[model samples]
Target chain A: MRFLTLVLRSLFRSKRRTFLTVLSLSVSVFLIALLQSLLGTMDALTTSTGSGTRFVVQDKASFTNVIPQAYTNFLRQQPEVERFTVLQWFGGEYKDPKNFFANFGVDPESYLQVYREEANLPSIPLEQVRDFLRDGNGCMVGRALADKFGWKVGDVVPLKSSIFNLTVRLNIRIIFAGLRKSDEMVLAFNIKQLQEAVPWMKGRVGAITVRAKNPADIPRLCERIDHHFANSAQETLSITENAFNLNMMKLLGDYSTMVHSISAAVLVAILIVTANTMAMAIRERTTQISTMRALGFRSGQILSLLMAEGLLLSLLGSGLGIALAMGVASAAAKVAGQIIPWMADFIITPETLLLCVLITLALGLLSTFIPAYRASRRPITEGLRAL
Target chain B: MDDVSVRLRNLAKSYWRGSLEIPVLTGIDLEIPRGGYYALMGPSGSGKTTLLNLIAGIDRPSGGELEVCGHSLNGLNDDELAGWRSRNVGFIFQNYNLVPVLNAYENVELPLLLQDLGRAERRERVLHALSLVNLTDRMRNYPRQLSGGQEQRVAIARAIVHDPELIVADEPTGALDAKNAEEALILLEHLNQELGKTIVLVTHDPKAASHARFQIHLEKGVLDRTVEVHDRPVLPRLLT
Candidate 1:
């Protein structure tokens, strides 16, 4: 109990310096936790949601290359194919290029039939969906996009295309009838309207989102779909929805590895900076440390004192730093939501909080090691001479 | 060797600078009688502090037989020596080495911590020690808050708190002015006369040396003269 007073008083000797050290450490931890929260987005696209009953038909070569949409009609005639729909990526930006939202072209009625996740749109009137999507220029917007542009049911929005090379005017239809307005990036527009607008886009789509009667028959159904288009002008690639998402992910080229490299670099830099600050603190307290030893504190006690001091300061610093980082992340979330939607939900949880504390402790311990050993081993005579 | 508190046979301490073995206290034999006030006066490098350190068990002799209070110092390990010293020897230095972090009472209570005394018993002992030097009123005063004389008195209180049989003071009055020095000498003399403590004081001041019943002078690394001043009882010795 009495020894703890020694540790506490020692910390207060340099109020400003100690406060700064603790603050820096806290900020560093917050940044790291933010990155960890971002990791929540990593999902095995096709393998995720684990509905092996779903199958896809696309170009095995890549998502950038299209597969024949005529294949979906042929697949529907097959015995194992219960339902199928073509999903197309409409790379369109609204108002300005920076105010972009994910615009995917999918079959209006049949798309809902294949995906139960998007099946609740009927609660909103069909007349409401039609009034907005009446013309070829008219298209429905996702709830995420609707919220972003402040779009109402009757408002018409203009969007420039990156892939099809045209300005697309889409109407704000019934906002996606789901709880996840954040998943608006995944919302779909009318495929027939998109196809009629682009004549050259005939019998072509990015991929097919299919569901088979029996999950075990997915391989057989996929083989049948490929066999019919074998060596044809528009041959098809058949796969599970998970495999389809995996193939899409390959375009990004090992995203997890890249994130890991970035995170590792950040962790190392934080360790070095925090350790340096603790070293300076220990160096400044050389005389006091020696006096403590002469007063009968053993080497281990001195080590504990320094360790406790460093840890406390770093935890405080990094805690403040994390708070700052969280503020920065919150500010960034608004801008990110313009493109990504609901990005603020990516938060630092309690596990992440503990990880931050451990990081501060590790850095503090590593930094205090040399100074504590030096101070603990210093001869009393030499230390007294310094005074 | 009668009434001997310490017995040293050919005590030698050598320092090695690089390849050279420079001997400090070579082939020295000394005996200190129990319950007597004595001063060891010596010039620089005369080994007075070193000799005092050896007798107090603060440092070990390189080649010697050192026996204090019937226990051989040469054979005792560091922990055993520390324990034995706490039980029998108390040390006071020129700087009044009272732990600055602790107050006067706590400073006196330090050595008592090593003893098996409980907190209440330790408190009583510390208070009694503080009252001995008339510093009970200043019990809560830290080293910085107390005067040099008061600090030295607190230090004396600390040394005697454990009731050690022998008290070794190295340059006790070396840092004090004439007035404080006289006052400190009187307190040391009072401990010698009233409590009959065996005191080994190493100092250069003649005034401080005059208070001790026996004074030994050293030059170089050896004792040159031994002077005795009798502070005997007024009445003849009784067979109590």
Candidate 2:
């Protein structure tokens, strides 16, 4: 601790160089944190605890393909099936195409029952749920969705479907909070209204979400449901909701690898930059280091002091970067939530922050080790000659 | 301990550049007794600084026994040599090698940091050393903020702050003006006579050599001559 002032003074000896190096480091660390958190968000998508009892039944060909509504009849007959809802993505624009959010056409009462845990339906007023089930044009919007548009109960919202070439006026009925922030960025209305608008969609649905009577029965129910539609004109694929999300993620093949590669590349680049900066700083102090050696400072002591300077530099840079990542992550999550509702949960978790700290320590030690060791081990007379 | 501050027997030093041996000092035998004032006088490439560095333990000899301040430097490892130096030898360089970032007081406090002294104790010793060099008022000023002479005084304060037994100065007044050089020489005399420190100085200036009681001249890595001066001047004014 007595040598702290010396180390700090040495760091600022080249103020401009130090400032630039720190700025570059902060930016690189910020990028690393953001990319790592993105990977975390993707991982979060496929590992929700509430999804264990819920299964999604989509067309075997592709999620974009619609399956027959007649599949629900078999689901209703199954003793393991507690409730089921038919869901269709209604890709719609509010005031502008840019103001896009997740809007779905669903069987209202059944959808609420299947997603009761996620929607936190126990907290909603019973009257609001009844109002949604009674009114044909009524819709249930997530709390975040309502907040985004400054919506209130009884407010009429008009959504124009880009795919169906029609506009549907929906009365806001129940505003529901969800188990996760990402879940609260959706709006759902009755599939009956969509069928009324386009008669061709009457007996079809994008997918069916089913809740099992017991979590243990989910795997068997999936297998049985898929077997019932085997060799049919409209084949179906039934999977737990988590597996469904995982399959959706697989569509963007090896995305984790890409994110990791980019992150590794950024880290390596920053390491090189920081190493060069430290080498230059140490080189500039060759004579001063020798003077210290001549004053009876051991090689180990010299190495320790230089390493401390490097560590302090790393901590300062990464500290700023982590704070910057947090602020930007919050804002970016909101903007991304408008287009991809699940992305609203994009966050720099404590685990990510801890990983960044470990990286900072490694960067500090690795970048400064070789140069500091060389300088400290250099013969004192040779260094004195540099004077 | 022995009254002899330094003793050398057939001391030799060489450098190698990719297996080609280059001798800097060879077959040197010398001694400077305790509280003795001596100067090493030689032209460039004459090994005066090399011998001083050997005696100061900053460099090791190629082959020979070298002892300074009652410690045999040949057997000591690099770390042990550094430890021995911290407890026994002080050095004043021609370039005034004060750390540019540290002020005069902090620079003087450098050697003390290697010791197990408390903050108050270190502060007291540093202030005393600065006072001895007449730099008490300039203690807070950095090397760049001080004049060349003042910088050298700070270096001298740093050297003596630990109160070592031997003070090895390599052309300490080489970069100073005439008045500053005279003042520095007088200060060296005060340290030798009043403080009873063994002073071994290396210089090319004949006038600087004249201030020492004995002068050892080197020529081509060997001792050429030794002269004793009976009329070494003592400036009482600077001593006060």
Candidate 3:
């Protein structure tokens, strides 16, 4: 504890150098934090608890290809399947191309039953559900989507569909909130209205969501469902909801590998910069180190002091970097939520913070070990003669 | 133990310049009794500083039986020697060698920190040592803020704060002006006589050498002779 002040004072002997090194380190750490958080957010979608019991059945060729709506009857007859719904990606633009959110055409009744845990609408009265089921043009919007467009109950929302080249208008009957922030970025309408309106989409859907009676039955059921449709004209692929979301992320093209590679690169760059800075600082203190040795301070003690300085410098820089990363992550969540609705809950998790701290500590030790050891191990006479 | 602070017999040191072995000290024999004050005077490259460093246990002798404060330095490893030096020897350098980042008090507190002393006890000893050097008022001033003499005095305080049995000073006042040099010499004399410290000083200045009770001269890495100074009177009694 007594040596702390000495180490700190020595570290700042060249204030400009120390400050610049710290600034560079902080910037690198901030970038690493962001990259790691991005990966963590993507991973969250695949690991979500609500996705455990759900399965997605899509065309075996590709998820983009539509599967027959007739497959729903076969899926409902399976004992492992409890309830299921048709979910068609509307791919609709609100007012402008930039104003985009996930708008899905779903069976209003079964959609609510399968996603009850994900979409929290406990406060919604039964009258709204009845109105949504009875009225063919009725729809339900999440609170976030409603707030975004100043939409209220009975407000007619006009959506321009890019896929079908059709304009669909529907009256909102329910403004729902969700158990999680990401869930509130969706707009679900009755698929019957879409089917009646579009001639080609009449007997097909983008995907079918099957809720398994038991989460443990998912693997077997998915395999069974895929085998059932293997010989059909339009073969089907059935996967756990988590795997489905992962496949969706795969469309963004190996982003996990890209983010991790960029993160590793950032770490290596900061390590070199920090190591160089530490080397320069230790070099300048060669004479002082010798004097301390002559004063009966052991080489190990001197080495520890230098290491402590490096560690402290890194921790300080990382602390500021963590704060900056959190602020930027919050802003990014808001902006990214508009473009990628599922990413509305993106955040820098505590696990990433812990991981970053460990990385910083390792970096500190790695960066300082060779230089500090070399400086400490030099003969006392040689060090004394330096300068 | 021969009641001596430092004892050497046939002590020799050499340096290797690439493949060549260059002898610095050869066939040196010396003894300075406990509480004795001695000055080593020699020309440049005469190995006086090298001898001082060896005596302080900061450098190892190439060959010899070297003992300071009753510890045989030859058998001790580097870490053992460091521990022995911390407990038994204090050092003052020509450049004042006080850590530039530390103020006088903190600098004086350095050696004591190597001990098992508590913070309060260390503080008390540091203050007392600074007081002995008459630099207590300047304890908070860093080495850069001090004049040459004041810095040397701070260095002296640092050297004695641990109350080591021996003090090895290499040209203690070499960087000081005449007035400061005289003050430093007086402080050394007081430390040797009043506090019963054994001081081994290496210097080129005749006036600085005059403050010691005896002088040893080194020539070409060999002990030339020893001279006893009769002009000054020893103190009547040890201060403590």
lDDT of each: 0.72, 0.91, 0.89
Model 1, A247-356: lDDT tens per residue? Answer: 55666787767766776887788777766776776766665565444334456667877888777777676668678766766676666766665462445556766777
Candidates by TM-score, descending order: 2, 3, 1
User: Per-residue alpha-carbon lDDT of model 1 for B1-240, expressed as tens digits?
Assistant: 458887889888877899998877877787878888889988888988878878877667889799887789898865576678778877777878766667898878877766778889999999988888889999988889999999999989988888988888978898899899887888887887778788999999887888888888777777777889675323322111
For residue B25, what is the lDDT in candidate 3?
A: 99
What interface RMSD does candidate 2 have? 0.6
* Per-residue C-alpha lDDT of model 2 across residues A1-387, encoded as one tens digit per residue: 899999999999999998998888889889989999999999888887578888999999998888889999999999999889999999978989988888999999989988888789999999999999999999999998899999999999999998989899999999998888788888999999998888779899999998898989999998998999999998899988998998889888888999999989989999999999999999988999998998899999999999999999999889988999999999988888767888899999999998888898899899999999999999999999984
Per-residue lDDT value at B233 in model 3: 44
Model 1 residue B142 CA deviation in Å: 6.4
Off by over 4 Å in 2: A77-82, A212-224, A247-253
In terms of lDDT, the poorest run of 10 residues in model 2 chain A is A44-53
**Candidate 3 — which pairs collide?**
none
Per-chain TM-score of chain B, candidate 3?
Answer: 0.95
Error of 2 at A45 (Å): 2.1
lDDT string for model 3 (A262-367, tens) is 9898999999999999998999889889989888889999999999999988898888889999999999888887688767887989988898888888988999
